[model samples]
Target: MDDSIKPNEDIGACIPRLRRYARALLGVRGEADDLVQDTLERAWRKLHLWRRDTELRPWLFSIMHNIFIDQRRRAPEETVSLDEHALEFPVAPAQERMMEMVDLESALRMLPAEQREVILLVGLEQLAYKDVAVALGIPVGTVMSRLSRGRERLRELMEGRQRVVALKVVK
Candidate 1:
């Protein structure tokens, strides 16, 4: 019975980033969308609980991480299909960049969940290490450790993949 009459307007600015994180976390557009919606809904309801002086982004992400784990526990593990949309590209001019992104996504998927969450929050979302810890409910040291290990594994994964060079011939 204590929702905020006026929530921070800036909260909306984080939606795009939240959507990106959710998509990366869940790997399915529909499921990711649902997760984002659930996070927002929970944040809205718990607006009163948020301290005005603290950052909102991490709080929202924390809610999302918690929801993801809870849902994961209640349901049996299912093989997450490689999101087809991540593979789609406009044309060849940017195909190289698109392919690189696909490789990155593939590598990310291979990481342990904790490490992946840390890497995504820290590297992709650009959240500070402390902020990432807050979101994942881990210590900053743990966040650093995970990030370090995740980056190393990703580098190893990417290095193992045969690099493709798309050459454009100009006559």
Candidate 2:
């Protein structure tokens, strides 16, 4: 067995999870793919910096997180302009499941980026609290707080109670 190739194999094993996180973060297929490609490129270039004793998955996630933050900083005003026609496609046969997914996606999009990232890392990606904190470079307390808020907001959004403004009595 070539010891030199072991790290590469380990990194390869993480690509699917990386892609999933990228897709969830970016919410667009092409953009997610681009982010993953950039992440891989960056990781390959910095492979020497990675310590053998450290876990690879969280390190890869941290790289992806930094890249994502950098990209967002570079284009703070960038928005995806979707075509209305593109969204008029037919629904899937499992309409209830599809609707639930749509609702979840909508709620996710509604979350603040920090909260969204924490929630996705903890909830969707199943990352541990400490790993999430390392990936985001935040304290564990902050992760807990953000995850709590994110879950609450998601629940509110899913339940159609996102609006918090109180109604005034009419004369």
Candidate 3:
């Protein structure tokens, strides 16, 4: 098999996951698709820069992460507000579980961008800590710290200790 073809195949396998992560990051199907498309384009263009010894999955993720950051910097207004749209989920067998899922989704959205990124990359995408570090261009220790804090904040939000308030009440 040609060595060049292997990377393309590997990247193809990661597309679904990349799209999932993008959707979670951007919170819109169209925006996520655009991010995925840009990521793939950049990855293909920079294929020669990839090291054979390094894992391809993390590299692709790194590309997507950088692209997301760049897009955010370029167009801050493009961010979608989670409160503007209702989160739709498939019918669940139990109402309690569905409510919990809804709460979790809301909590996830409330997290800070850094914490959210770490949580999504490590928890949702199932990337290793070191791989997440590389993808985010941060230290592994920072990744661990962010993940810990993010999980704690998520727990607090879900437990209703830190309620998501739209407006403050005043006397």
Report the number of the highest-lDDT candidate.
3
- lDDT tens digits by residue: candidate 2, 49-117: 887777788889889999999998999975754731233335878978877777787678788888989
Q: Rank the candidates by TM-score, best first.
A: 2, 3, 1
TM-score of 2: 0.84
Q: Tell me the number of clashing residue pairs for each predicted model.
A: 0, 0, 0
RMSD of 1: 5.2
State how far residue 138 of model 3 sits from its true place (Å). 0.5
lDDT of each: 0.82, 0.83, 0.84
Give the backbone clash total of model 2: 0
Q: Estimate candidate 3's RMSD in Å.
A: 3.9
Candidate 3 residue lDDT tens string, 95-127: 988877777776777888789999999899899
- Model 2 is weakest, by summed lDDT over 10 consecutive residues, at 162-171
Clashing pairs in 2: none
